[model samples]
Target: MKNLLIGTAVLAMTAGAALAQDVVRLGTEGAYPPYNFLDDNGEVAGFERFLGDELCKRAELTCEWVTNDWDSIIPNLVSGNYDAIIAGMSITPEREEVVAFTQNYTPPSPSSYVGTSDGIDPTTAVIAAQTGTIRAAHVSTMEGATLVEFPSPDETVAAVMGGEADLTLADKDFLIPAVEESGGALVFVGDDIPLGGGIGMAFRQSDPELRDKFDAAVQSMKDDGTLNEMILEHLGANSPTF
Candidate 1:
């Protein structure tokens, strides 16, 4: 009887340790480039990939990547589809109410309007924005503009190019490459609009311990200046850093 009780206690302790070290799945939208995206090899790659890996290392946590569509990313997180969101998710009051967020990793970026031609008045033009993004929310508030929603960021750009919409509003970092590749086919149509509090990792409100672990990891990167270097490398020198 004594031996059996000792073996049972040992087993319980081992199980607890295993549960503590369970793999943390980092969720992201694989379509968003320079943030999180699938490479030619179909593996997750880019800035967020690099950042998430480093954070997991610093926190001594086992981690893996999982992709979900942008429209359903938050809902999926809430439903326990993954442990945390490492996609380029901006911190906003509306979002904070649903999921807890780590400190800002990247500084607030300006949202810009891109159109096929210059001098297009964005105030009254038909504007395309990715559905469920802060940019789309902002566009909806524009009194004279018509807001057209698309399921993906690429589709929002296509809406402007295909004449489905006069312009598209999105993160300047994401649009810069598209405009450059367009070879004058696309131009900045209006002033850049700043929105959101910056990008951060998000976890379910129930996972405060997990959130704190990653938050400390993020702060360590910022303190060491590595995060700033990464921001300049992946997002361009013009991007604001920690």
Candidate 2:
């Protein structure tokens, strides 16, 4: 899960302003795998792709996928570039003030620290996190730790690998594969830190009807056990379910 305060420049639209549009655009950051990413053919693919498609079908809405950079994903949604944000965005009070969020699609996930070795103390180490993420905010508040931010998640991992930072904090799911493939170069350090409420679809505050539709669709998936199955399939067996 991740969080960042909304900027002041965004102005909310009136109710129903975007809901009347014919095609609903689902925005996502195509870089985060398992959640959402680009396939070899450059199409959006992964857990969210499947989930969003099913949601559209269940809601009886014609939808299209749109990829946006992670940092600007929310702003673009607010700017009407898309109708909804299905990026692995965490539910946080700071963000809720700007955009309306549907019921969460995924439960709270733990954030972990990945480093070159096991003995390093994350509390005082130079920690790297993607800019605008909850992990970065958490690191900044640690009394002795130094927070280094990068524009992308991949660069956060690279910082630790290159010795630019003592550790990188990110979603446990996102780091697990990287650590596994590192061949012992990277290991999890410190306790797993839980952050944010959960993952959800975000819509403009004015688009309550559209938000409600997706919320019902998400609830339908949960009620039928399909969401849980998809969670286990894409997020590993240990992943939390509805």
Candidate 3:
């Protein structure tokens, strides 16, 4: 549902670059639908799954998928559990301090405020955001808003639906699917807030060589318009492409 993540602050952990191997493991939080998530078949399936597969194909690398919780995804990567993270992770200063990011695969999409018809005043309303995300960081800065943090994007939305929060802030792309599927249960309120940089693949900083390989593949996809095409197919024609 986000590049919005859930976690505590972490210190950067360094490791040696992955040695040449037969298969490169790709890590993702297999819970955020439309980006990466388990399908009805119980296999990883979604936009990032397809994108990651295409990237592996173009880079001529043997790859496999590994699911991880959002809170520990980065740490796992640092511990060498996976070669890279293709989850919907935004490139941010705090995150950058811990891991290296590829050139953005998706440009920064709009962040939306979703709530009932009742207008929410940032000055006093209770707001829910996923922990460790830019949205949570934003809400924390509000002068008077009561901030509630959850471990996943779904939990943040649940907080609003369950009446624990007055409203929630999250990716517009993720919320649109819910709003349309909800049949009027949710509606957009307030102006769209654009937060952080675009979504990118994350890797250990020591793996710049590996990062370079994927970066070239991403650039090729962008150059041939394949990246934007995938974005349209998954996120919709109206969604802005890189």
Candidate 4:
């Protein structure tokens, strides 16, 4: 697990990077595989990383990857710890009050649940989700659910694996891969729940210009079919398009 770093120490460094104007800091939680994760070489790798680099390249911007714990991502961005957040962050009205988001690169993904077996009960189950995520917020609203949140998604997975949680909820893209990796250890349970709109790049409220640049790049990718290609490559061809 990564320690939460939300102090001013990182802010100075981030502000300096922003001041440079030539380089755009792309913030992400590297723990979420298939969205953003450390590759075999221990560098940022996965769909969003690939898409982010392409967006920066098309926008004629130099990009730097910055990894941070998910719980404090927004505050750290507001504090100038990074220029923009490119993690698998979903767009929602509540979040709009805090930051501006670029156009979505992927369509809304279904939030699904998984358990050690097929017989889990959502009405009384202790469900694990990553703290500060849309999944956590949505889970909290579930009428009979008991949300057991963790600082990270990996820990949420651990909660289910260790019997600490009866089930866990996450994007189908994430849960499907986890289930496949689990062999017969885990199984999907309950209907797929629709949550937020889609995934977007987040920026400080005052940074509309930066958001616009990314928005344009994302649009270009969609128009040329490159965005769908990337999504299909990582998320399967049946994956939803923007």
Best by TM-score: 2
- Give the TM-score of each candidate: 0.91, 0.94, 0.91, 0.91
Candidate 1 global lDDT = 0.87
Model 3 C-alpha lDDT per residue in residues 1-242, reported as the tens digit of each score: 12222211221233334537788899999888788889888899999999999998988888999999888788788767888999999889888877889999999988888877547765688998887778888889998898899888888888888899988888888888877886788788889898989999998777777788889999999999999999999988777897
Pairs of residues at least 3 apart in sequence or in different chains that clash in candidate 2: none
Regions more than 4 Å wrong, model 3:
1-16
**lDDT of each candidate versus the true structure:** 0.87, 0.89, 0.83, 0.85
Give candidate 4 misplaced runs (Cα > 4 Å): 1-20
Supply every candidate's count of residue pairs whose N, Cα or C atoms clash at under 3 angstroms. 0, 0, 0, 0
Superposed on all Cα atoms, model 1 deviates from the true structure by an RMSD in Å of 8.8
lDDT of 4 at 106: 90
Q: Candidate 2: lDDT of 44?
A: 98
Q: What are the runs in model 2 whose C-alpha is more than 4 Å off?
A: 1-13
Comparing 1 and 3 by lDDT, which wins?
Answer: 1
Task: Compose the digit string of candidate 1's lDDT tens values, residues 60-105.
Answer: 9999999999888887776667878998899998888777899999
Q: RMSD to native for every prediction?
A: 8.8, 2.7, 4.2, 4.1
